[model samples]
Target: MSDRIIQSNKEELYASCIKRKMEGWRLAQICAVTINDGFEMSYTFVKDSDMDTLRICLKEDEPISSITQIYPCAFLQENEAAELFGVHIENITMDYKHKLYRIEADTPFKAKEDA
Candidate 1:
């Protein structure tokens, strides 16, 4: 199926997730990328042969809500995004407390300050 994208915001994150779950969609993957000075993310869902992506953007330090309540499997990717990209995702079901990885840099994917 052709990929479809939905522009979303922080306020609509949870509600949209619940709606998708009720519509027989399952969380397929959570992906993220660094934007100019922030983050852009996609929460992909699947049902039968269809796929939909709910996308959102956020500032570098903006605290984003977690969807672990609706999709418990989301904690893994959510933690990875928060720990690596400094996405500030809060209320993760299985929060790794930024210890998901054993790397030296706190936010390795984030741009380093000029030393």
Candidate 2:
């Protein structure tokens, strides 16, 4: 199946997710990539045989709304993203409070600055 990508801003995240869900897409995965000063979040969804991805770029301090209301299984992915990348995912159905991983340092994926 082919993959389709859609770029979205923070404000449009929730609505875009709702549209996808209404279109019969099932949430597949949520992932984040560390950028210079922020992170790029990708929400992947699958419908029929095709995969659709919604990408949103967010600053370190920016908070993203949880899609758990739309896809109940999203809490796990949101928790991982929050724990590993330090992205603030707001209103998640279940917040693991960074207990998803037992690492010594938080935000392990954050880029280090020469202090």
Candidate 3:
């Protein structure tokens, strides 16, 4: 099946996840990549043979609503995004408060300061 991307915004993130869940899709993963302005975040959902992703862009340190309320397991990915890429996720059901990993540098995948 072809993979599709659903561009989403912070305000509609939670609802988007809920819709996917109701459609029998499961949360596959969440990832973040640093951009010139901030970060591009993607939440992947899969069901049967189809894969759809919800993508959003947020400024550094800007908070995005957590989908853990709909998908409790999202806590892990949300935490990873926060600690590894500086994507601020708010209201995680089981927030580790940035202690999910043992990395030394903060937001190592973030954009270079000298860039």
lDDT of candidate 2 over 36-104, digit per residue (tens) = 789999999999999988899998889988989999999999999999989989999999999998899
If ranked by TM-score, best first, what sequence of candidates would result? 2, 1, 3
Which residue pairs show collisions in model 1? Answer: none
In order, the Cα lDDT scores of the candidates are 0.91, 0.91, 0.89
Candidate 1's residue-wise lDDT over 87-106, tens digit each?
88989999999999999988
Model 3 scores a TM of 0.92
Q: Which 10 successive residues of model 1 have the least lDDT summed?
A: 106-115
Cα lDDT over the full model 2: 0.91
Query: How many clashing pairs per prediction, in order?
Result: 0, 0, 0
- What are the C-alpha RMSDs, in order, of all predicted structures? 1.2, 1.1, 1.4
Order by lDDT, highest first: 1, 2, 3
Candidate 3 whole-model C-alpha lDDT, 0 to 1: 0.89
Off by over 4 Å in 2: none
